[model samples]
Target: MKQLKSFIKKEFFHIFRDPRTMLILFGIPVVQLLVFGTVIKSEIKDVHIAIYDQSKDETTKEITNKLLSSGYFILDENLNNLDGIDAIFRKGKVREVIVFENNFGQTLGKEGTAKMQLIADASDPNIAKLAISYTTAIVNDYIRKLYPEMQLPMQITPEVRMYFNEEMKSAYMFVPGVMALILMLISAMMTSISITREKELGTMEILLVSPLRPVQIIVGKVLPYLLLSIANAFIIVLIGHFVFSVPVNGSFILLMLETILFILMALCLGILISTAAKNQMTAMFISMIGLMLPTILLSGFIFPIENMPVVLQYFSHIMPARYFITIVRTIMLKGTGIFFIWKETAVLIAMTLFFIAVSVRKFKIRLE
Candidate 1:
């Protein structure tokens, strides 16, 4: 019995000694809990919206104030005309626009009904639906409370228009997100694992000692994967288009260019991961845990980033997938050109250069 007890204590010590083991046992669960708790929210918060109140009447003013005071939405701009509606949405400035028809208050008072249009960017169907629903509810509630004792019940009729995706297909949302995930995992994880395999087999030293420079070695390792990943991306886009009925409304060449940039960035990130990893398993683990979770949770893929906590929302800016998904959704859904997506493209380019620079510096250290 004493020998068995001693063996159990020894096993406990062994488990505690391995940091990876302890992390898997405790750290991961805590992180998952916090991420799931904070990120997975159904309600919208601080959603940016525009308003075109042609009436500028007391009733319209009250309704606008109610929307802003509700804490779910923030006024991004007040549109003077309908021309700016498409421009704002294409620029990705606002999610929804509230357009109150001319003479709204007078019409409501005289005819007991007024027309209001709720135009939402439906590239992300869930958010658009939720925003419209919330807006409609607020308007209806206001009508009931404001005119409860009136002879005729006054109603504000909201005509909802979901831009980009009029039918609100779920595939329009998921295809872009899945594309980002697949490219990130395949490019980053595979590159890291392949490079780590060389170290495991003792071939890395031979290559390092050879006449090949660090930049050359990195490029050689990344090029094959880059080509293959581009092919993979093309296939994913094609399948999304044909099978899922997702559209490519923007410049196809620009979309492909952006896709390649993302793949290259992912490859550089994998090289960075490989620098620290000792073996294929370590590389795979880091890629899955480090890249996958952030892409899924913090990238605004499944959940809206605006709905997350302020800290999490801040952290999300660093997520590469977030930018890529935005670019993809904008090009494919909104049909915007490089002028609209230049910011996201520049961010990916900067990330690629940063990863390559770090990886090269690390390689030089190894060489020395």
Candidate 2:
């Protein structure tokens, strides 16, 4: 017990004594959260829209006023003719153009309907869809108020309920992703590099010559990092909660347990990586190229898996971060319990065991 405590203390001292390690463990999580929350915005606000109101009547004017007042849109410039529509879109600042037909008010008054054209730049398909949806909703509301007495036999209005992210904040999506990313990177990369550094310095043989058993040595090395990684996980969640208004709808204790599980998984994978790599540079290269890219791209961190090709979707299934992200979003955003995330939890556990087994085999062979 005393020796293990001394080993854990030595590992912590090693980490604290290194300035780079301290920065990575203590500084990076807060920095990444601020960047994702403040800089990488998800929701559309104050989208610039252009109008070509050929009608120039009270109805069109009222509708325009309603759109601008809705706070989703800003009038970039009004068009005199449709010819300049192309030029406006070419500028790229204006996202959409609304063109109302001539005699819009008169037609609506007599026939209860007037046509309008919505031309949007499809360069950014998501923004274009959102802008169109916002404009259409405002127009429909105006029409309802204008012709309340014009009753039809049937009416169907679709009520959309945005679950998890009520405000559609990008931070809600990115925070979990960033947490997964940071935890994986710091644990796997740092551990592998640390182990490889021992090998490079020829200190690994000295440790093996000491009284500590091989398993004890490995455990001691991992203990400090495991605790540190857990602390980092809590720090990320705290910043995400208080700073970005992200909610943790599920049991907080369950969240912490899952985070610890993931950190262990990452640490085990790091051990396996250390056995494979001959030096610090090689370990770092493998960790960055192998783990970092997959975590960001294939984990559904930035893109939707369903939208990916069939082969890529199958490939993403192998990514541990993919399951972790889903689990986190479900727990934090949906407040789902373990029953809801049992499948993901099972997968993470399976992956952790697989990594630990493989690393143990490799470490034993290296010792022999």
Per-residue alpha-carbon lDDT of model 2 for 39-87, expressed as tens digits? 6766678999999999999999999999999999999999999899999
Instruction: List all candidate RMSDs to the true structure.
Output: 15.9, 2.0
Per-residue C-alpha lDDT of model 1 across residues 210-263, encoded as one tens digit per residue: 676777667767766676678777777777788667899999999999999999
- Candidate 1, which ten residues in sequence have the lowest lDDT sum? 29-38
Each prediction's total of clashing residue pairs, residues at least 3 apart in sequence or on different chains, is: 0, 0
Query: Which candidate gets the maximum TM-score versus the true structure?
Result: 2
Best by lDDT: 2
User: What Cα-based lDDT does every candidate model obtain?
Assistant: 0.84, 0.91
What TM value does model 2 have? 0.93
